[model samples]
Target: MIWPFNRKTSTETGAEYYIRDAAIADAKTLVDFKHRIWRDMFGHLKDEAFFTQAEATTDEQVKFWQSRISRGDTVWMAEDLRDRLVGTLHATTKHSEHTAEFVAAHALGELHELRYFYLTAATAETTIGTELIRTAIGDQPAITWLMGHAPLVETNLRQAGFEPLGEPIDPSDAPWKGIPRQAMVRQ
Candidate 1:
């Protein structure tokens, strides 16, 4: 059963888990989740000091989330039965095709950018990832283009009908750091 796209609580799990468009009030949670997940997952890629120095917080992430959500973008969360948010996935509609260096040059102009979706380590397999992606791209079934950072879990997405495109791209401008991201398109 699909929950309301604007609410975050779920009835069956009593976990308050739901995928809905994020709001300004969700900023702190979003930021905390991002930081926590990063420390938990990407700690080996770079120094934990960077994240600390970056001073990234839920309020900041929320501000960005609020801006995007306010502009037709959506962010989904996986909360516990106790209403504690555990993970998040952020997706936005791109007006223009996003060109990634790894994409076949010929296919660049033909794709739509279903950008940015992530799940917390603890909430990774709770079906939150699949649910969030479905919420974002389900209705527009024909627009079969999406991408994200998850080489380790590519198979899960593949099973869901998303095929890996090419190598992943760096989500930031920092030249010293890079993450292994995987891209997918509908087959």
Candidate 2:
């Protein structure tokens, strides 16, 4: 449903937009938003070959978001006054196996890298990205592994009390062929 921007609702104030859990029905919208954001954020990252191949396709993104929702992960989105989703956050519940192994790798006696958090690019002024990170962190204090990259992602992550753990790492696990993916971690 298109959220009325100026209309008063329990979800948000008139002056600003708000965030909510993404639904299966939002698949198409999410895909479109994803394409736009990716094109903007990574359009200039590498060679044209990489850009063309890694470009966001509607079908691919829809399937991805659908899978994320079906897997029980939550996708939070921010709608502008026009009811358009300008920003998005995708997060999975705290990891068990990875966190345990990470602790061992780091040699920490007791470590808790709770959940993994990610955000999509949109208008920088809205601060929706920042709010999404904050909300997720607030909901799950155990989340210790927030992940993202880019200058904006770093800024938002820092605002949420996350520290720079290291350089960004590629997020794509499959042989997607051309699109390059990278992510930064915060604890």
Candidate 3:
């Protein structure tokens, strides 16, 4: 569904942008955006072999996003006035089993995961990201979790009422292994 409060002006360009529910056609664009943002953020920290592996997963990413959108997860996209997809956000009740355990252990009721929330560098300073996150959260008082890597995202989440859940963990088993990531919760 299109969010009613999504319209905003970019601070950098003063161009209008809107956030709305993503469609199946957005899968490819989302994947491309994901690649761009991922590389921009982590490229210098990773090896060519890692990037090659990421390149090989394009189809998988497309399918994964498509399935999420089709399954009625809260997937929203921010588009410029020209209708170019510039950013995306996704939230869902579905999370890793370990995440569920974490929720239960903390007594966070029916938590939802902020699975993906990203903006292209050009649009990163706009209010669009905040609005998208608010749209996903709505009136739900339950806990929500987000893994924060970048300082901007962490600051935004904190400003939006999330707090660090615990110490940062080293993602030793994943790509960008050894990179410290913090788990945050909105409660």
Candidate 4:
């Protein structure tokens, strides 16, 4: 469902981007958004090999998103006037295999997970992310991981009553590990 730009939603007003449900065809665009987020997050390091490795997983990433969207996960996306995807909030009552491992590791039970929340730099500081978060998860108790680099996300999570879950850890798996992320849970 595409949200009309001029229409005001319960959570936000004057938003430059419209929030909508993502379709299966959006899998590639979601993958591209992931790449853009990674670029903004790590490009300044100028790590060519890391980016090359990330590129190697593009098809796999696209497929993963396709599966998620098809299965009714990660359903929310924010788009601009031109219909370009600017942001998304991946929240679900179910967990992915790796995320289930994370929940097990953290001893979290009976909680939804906000796996990935990304917005282009332009929208990063706007209310769009907050609106998406509220719309997707509401006051439901849930868990989320935020990279240390995204102060805006951290702030938004904090505003939504999410507190630090544990010590910071690098979320990346082997072969590419440099980020220090914090886990938070709304309790």
Candidate 5:
């Protein structure tokens, strides 16, 4: 968590967990966290109709995360005091074309995409999520996909200066087919 509620500090506090850059060794843990949180956020991941291309390939997710880390895009993982995975934050230079178009239409300039910032249900009300976000993007302008299912997260983003753009960024793949995703931007 962000100790003393200081966004300026990046050091781990004497809280429940600490955040750090994800390493290659963390692939499996990271993948597991993604699935668990997906279930927490989206509920129908196991329904099979929503698709599993991404879910079916743990190795691909690992490689994708490794690529993000190697490319130095913002990818941070949170671990509890016992060193167990608890949360994650990823901001990427890569985003959907719709996001790009909306940014261009509004003249928002270059902005990183806050791909996903997830904290387990246990850490939801804590400062760890905020810490991860501040560490990942600081005060830089950025965009992100907000789950309509997560009101508190959206509220936090709004407080951080992100607002919904256009109608909503349409889901491109099967995995995201039924989930409502809005492109929130900060210029």
Candidate 6:
């Protein structure tokens, strides 16, 4: 289901932006945006060699996002006045018993995982990201893995009513290995 929302750029400026369900055709753009945002936010934490070896190429990211979009994962995109994609949020229902167990432990029902939530630097100054997150998680209890370094994301989630729960889990084999990530939940 698509959750549509509209918000003005900033209180001082009245430019409007739209947030809607992502389409398969948006996969490439979404991937590119993700890459740019990721590098902008976390690149300084890693060396050039690590990025070269760990980051997925544009084609790989395109295929990954396309598959997720086609599979009907709850993905939302934020677009500017010109309809350029600037932000994205994706969520998936809990599928694994282990994840379900974690949700149960947190006293959250039928949990949905916040898979990817990001906004371009330009759009980050706006309320678009918060609205996208709020709409995406709508009446369902949700959980997310948050990097320790991403204070902005943590603050956003907390403002949306999510709280840190459990200990930080190590993403051993992922590109984010060695980065501390904590699980957060909102009921």
Clashing pairs in 2: 114-143, 114-144, 115-143
Q: Tell me how many clashing residue pairs each candidate has.
A: 6, 3, 0, 0, 0, 0
Assess every candidate by TM-score. Answer: 0.68, 0.64, 0.81, 0.80, 0.80, 0.78
Candidate 5 per-residue lDDT, tens place, 41-83, comes to 7774336433365578878888887776676665698887667
Over 1-187, each residue of candidate 1 has an lDDT whose tens digit, in order, gives 9855534455665544666666767766777766666665566776767777655454565678778767766667666656666656554434333344434463544344454445555564566666666776663321223322343234445655676566555566552346544456663
* After superposition, candidate 6 runs with Cα above 4 Å error: 1-15, 54-56, 95-101, 104-107
Task: Name the better of 1 and 6 by TM-score.
Answer: 6
lDDT of 2 at 185: 41
lDDT of 4 by residue, 1-187 (tens): 9956543332365446788888889888877887778777667654878778888898998888888788767568988767778778888777767557777887778788896688776675677877888889888888887763676677778878889977877656754367666678886
lDDT head-to-head 1 vs 2, winner: 2
- Which ranges of candidate 4 are over 4 A from the true structure? 1-13, 44-46, 96-108, 171-173
Q: Judged by TM-score relative to the true structure, which candidate is superior, 1 or 5?
A: 5
lDDT scores of the candidates, listed in order = 0.55, 0.56, 0.71, 0.76, 0.73, 0.73
Off by over 4 Å in 5: 1-13, 44-46, 49-53, 170-173
The alpha-carbon deviation from the true structure for residue 25 of candidate 4, after best TM-score superposition, in angstroms, is 0.8
lDDT of 3 by residue, 49-79 (tens): 8778987999999899889788876588888
lDDT at 165, model 5: 80
- Residue 162 of model 3: what lDDT? 75
At residue 43, give the lDDT of candidate 3.
66
Best by lDDT: 4
Task: Give model 2's TM-score versus the native structure.
Answer: 0.64
Model 1 weakest lDDT span, ten residues long: 139-148
lDDT of 4 at 180: 68
